[model samples]
Target: MNLNLRHAIIQNVASNTKEELEDTIIDAIRSQEEKMLPGLGVLFEVIWQNANEDEKEEMLSNLKDGLQKQ
Candidate 1:
């Protein structure tokens, strides 16, 4: 079977409002389910692609801090 997971995920949430998107992200993180990782990754990819250099740096710093907490 052929599947475009990223495209599918993007399409699934394309119409969501900001609040709905926030809820989805929070739910996915709280669930901590393996199946949700790809969705989160796709979301992050979207964010990364759209972010400015300063925003990207902030994200990288946040990620670094998060990893250090582990």
Candidate 2:
């Protein structure tokens, strides 16, 4: 069986509205469950893929700050 988690995750949320997507992200973060990590990673992958250079730089900067705080 070939199970592509990233593809599955993306397909699952493909029809989500902006607010639904926001809720999904927020809920996943607040859940703190290991299983949710893959879904979050998939979402981040989509965001990173579509982000412009400036957005990517901002994301990296935010990521750096987040790591520092942790």
Candidate 3:
């Protein structure tokens, strides 16, 4: 069966408030499960698409810092 995973994920969380979204993201990260990566990627995609240039720069910087910790 063909499934639109990205669309399905977006639809599933579309009605969530900011706090709920934050909790979902935090939980997904803390779970440390490979299955959650796609959901986090989707959330990052949404954030990137809506972010301004400065915000994007900040995100990139934060990502770089995060990677450096490993």
Candidate 4:
């Protein structure tokens, strides 16, 4: 994402309620058709997979037991 895109995402998500965030995410996914799904999954999976390595061991540990605080 570019600077504007990053700022927009942060502002949008930070200012919204949980329901609104969920709705926005769903809408964004819908707007992208199926193509963006793979990209999104790839993003998550990259973090999930790489975090297992020594470099991210600490983060990986937290992720497993971390509270899903909204």
Give per-residue CA lDDT, model 3, range 1-70, as digits (tens): 1248988889999999999999999999899999999888888999999999999999999999999999
Candidate 3 C-alpha error for residue 43, in Å: 0.5
Each candidate's TM vs. the true structure? 0.93, 0.92, 0.91, 0.40
Highest-TM-score candidate: 1
Candidate 4: tens digits of C-alpha lDDT, residues 1-70: 4556545545545676878766766786789877556444543544566564675777656767675642
lDDT of each: 0.93, 0.93, 0.92, 0.60
The whole-model C-alpha lDDT of candidate 3 against the native structure comes to 0.92
Error of 2 at 10 (Å): 0.4
Query: In model 4, what is the error at residue 43, expressed in angstroms?
Result: 10
Return whichever of 1 and 3 wins on lDDT: 1
Q: Could you tell which candidate, 2 or 4, scores higher by TM-score?
A: 2
Two-way lDDT contest, 3 vs 4, winner: 3
Clashes of 4: 0
> Using alpha carbons, what is the TM-score of model 4?
0.40
lDDT tens digits, residue span 1-70, model 1: 1259888999999999999999999999999999999998998989999999999999999999999999
lDDT of 3 at 42: 88
